[model samples]
Target: MSGASIRAPYDNPMDRHLATTSASPTLVTGAAGFIGFHVVRKLLQRGAAVVGVDNLNAYYDPALKEARLALLRGADGFSFHQIDLSQRDATARLFAETRPETVIHLAAQAGVRYSLTHPESYVDSNLVGFGNVLEGCRHNGTQHLVYASSSSVYGANTHMPFSVHHNVDHPVSLYAATKKANELMAHCYSHLYGLATTGLRFFTVYGPWGRPDMALFKFTRAILAGEPIDVYNNGNMRRDFTYVDDVAEGVVRTAALTASANPAWGGDAPDPATSAAPYRLYNIGNTEPVDLMTMIGVLERALGREAQKRYLPIQPGDVPATWADVDALVQDTGYRPATPLEDGIAAFVAWYRDYYRA
Candidate 1:
């Protein structure tokens, strides 16, 4: 690590950052995934010296992920590390080499539906791997740590918009349970080590170079191939579909601002979301839950082809709807997602077509 503050790029807002030593680099754990690639791109645009680590696993299409990595590999202040965080020594060695002051840990086994078939994967990546990250941060003297949680953690809740303050104990899937476990584990780290930690709960994130496993990407493929797309719960589902760039923006802003201890927090009647230690959790979402049918309509319009729909009941480990309550996020960070659903979907479809020549 170098010992000077690298000037942020010209496009950054005046108050977006503070002067800091350059010896501590910024590290992103899942730099090749949809949200991770976007997050890495944003950090690079701001002239932040960054390190991106990923195994480039064949979770979806390794070729697509390789394309994302290709984009980052050419940047001036960016570097890539091919490693899995579940391998304790390998993960620890990378952290030691980077000496990062701020870390964005987004590498994890994703997808609620897939968790049913691959529960062990979640245990390895989301649990043990996260433990490795916490241990690394603890020994490295990291100033602040930002990581991804998910709205899937809002399982078994009928609440209109999920709030950070809400108790998220009733997880309906192994995936949600693992995310909830992350918040809990992070809370413990904050309490024991006084580490500044923030957990961001993202809604349905979609965009170009997006995961082929997500609904939007899958539907696009199905519709383009002249096949019937699965319309779960007979098209009754709703999602707060957030754009990938918007999510990346929120995450960057959060990681730069060090979390602070809540002055009013108490133990007798504890709030699971915040702590007297320098720890906080927030929802970064579109704040607009669009119906599945409406989203399909937008995709159809973008593709210029009506979807052949096969309506079916909701799959196990899947929820009917998801909305995010980001009031606290706005009050703290002064930024919220403003992109409309139509614009995001259209952009994704355009990028998908160009990337795959569909």
Candidate 2:
């Protein structure tokens, strides 16, 4: 592995927070997935040995996952494993063999609409898979486990700029419910097993090589193909669309800073974001919510194609607006997501055009 720090394009103030070298490899689940792939690259660039695990399921395109994996395979200090985390025995063996000191758990069934039809996938991947990961970390002497939570957990929450301290008991979708469950499960482990766990509730993350099912990717494809793109809630939605690199930076920085007991935490007040145990939760986002139609306009400019809009009512389990309050993340990491919407969209469109040869 090269001992050089992460270079430009991916470089940020958080680079200083990364350890020069780790005694044990950092294991990142869903390494083939979009966010996991970026996080792994960032870690490997910082000279950290990374054991990347992904089942490469056909939920979307396994080809894209494989492509992401191929890039990581070429990098030094990075290794890939094909393992379905829902399988208890396989996950246990992986933990025993790798014994990673820091585990970044990013694998889970991701999608809101799909969850309505295929609720079983959410159960197997998000709930069962997450349980296996927690078990692995608890038994393997893992120092810290920084896992992905989603802004979707703010379901039915009308409060603008969602804060981690707010209660999230009313999840509108199974996917969101499962993510909330992961936080609760992590808290249980931290309270009982002395595990240091941090949960990051990421807003709508988008950039180059993002997931196919996400709005940005789908809209880009539809517009380029001259198909009418579905405009849900009649383009009335608002999202804190964070850049992928920014999210990755937050993940790595938070991983380096292990969770600790909040001395001020009390049973009387009982803060939801922190605890007496070594558990913490933060909202990692751009902090700026963009209108759906405005984002579409930006993308139109980037791709030089106008999308034919098909207006539709909001789908079940979909929130009309999402805004993330990232004050806690900034206070902890001394970094905030500052990518401009135009720049991020341009980057994604460039990658999309190049990758598709369009």
Candidate 3:
């Protein structure tokens, strides 16, 4: 979809069938975010008119977000707006002005641990902000809405590979709860207003420009600085660490393939991932779960330094493991993420070194 080769792994030539082509601009929220930045870059490379919006909050380092924004500023057919979706007036005004054809909504208050400390942030950003986005899409005649959900929605379900078809009523953390709420809210819009919506349940996403709070970034920083790294769950956690590039590709593909009502869907035996209305849910993950220790080892090799790890019990509101069943996504989009831990870690370490001038 861009000058940069999209390396989404699948042997289906029909992938181009879902590719989107429109005169109206594509709206990307959280344009300064890690995944959002990559998505915008890819869309810009494809010569799509894009309007980006972000409050540029201090959730993490604003400078990192600023750096991402700066890269997008150089691209043609790209525009940026500093607006908060939580604010109803501003969000409404933005939609009225731009009136985007397709929307990729990624902005939210992320992190399970942070949600414990700041629960209100989740409600405001995830719930309230998402409601605003849905309204904006509905009122503006937006064709398709691709919003971010999380693998954490699986919560207490000990299922090996989390499936969108599985029930997700028992969310462990507030962050997870809010993401689940986003899906429900999108379904409401899709049902009542005839809006097309797709919810992406992202796995543990990481790569170049990953959030500093994530394990990869923290571990790399501590190891390089000769500091001790916190290894939670006594190094017994597992995650389907999907690379950012692959995740971005999935987002783009999903956005292109607008949600459509499932003719086979019936209330007698409901499928959680799809509905009679134009609403769908798909997990975007690597599908392979790697142990925490294995990830650390990969990082050590990438940085050429062993971490001084302090093993600890699993914290509250944290899961022991998370793996995704992406059969639905592959069936729908003909794409699956295949970035190995070794290669992804190497790329991240290289980027971290260069960006920080380490």
Best candidate per TM-score, number? Answer: 2
Give per-residue CA lDDT, model 1, range 1-358, as digits (tens).
Answer: 2212323454445224522445567999999988898988777667677899999998788998889888778677788999999999998899888888899999999999889999999999999999999999999888889999999999999978889989899999999999999999998999899989999999999988888899999999999999999999999999999998889888988887789898999998888678899999999999999999999999999999999999899999999999999998888878899799889888998898899899
Winner by lDDT: 2
For residues 233-263, write the lDDT of model 2, one tens digit per residue. Answer: 9899999999999999899999988899999
Show the colliding residue pairs in model 1. Answer: none
Candidate 3 has a TM-score of 0.95
lDDT of 2 at 33: 97
Q: Write the per-residue lDDT of candidate 3 for residues 13-72, one digit (tens) a residue.
A: 433333335677899999999999999877765556789999999999999999988877
Q: Which ten residues in a row have the lowest lDDT in candidate 3?
A: 1-10
TM-score of each: 0.96, 0.96, 0.95
Residue 233 Cα positional deviation in candidate 1, in Å, after optimal superposition: 0.7
lDDT of each: 0.88, 0.92, 0.90
What does candidate 1 score on TM?
Answer: 0.96
| Quality of model 2 by C-alpha lDDT | 0.92
Off by over 4 Å in 3: 1-20
Query: Which window of 10 residues has the lowest lDDT sum in candidate 2?
Result: 1-10
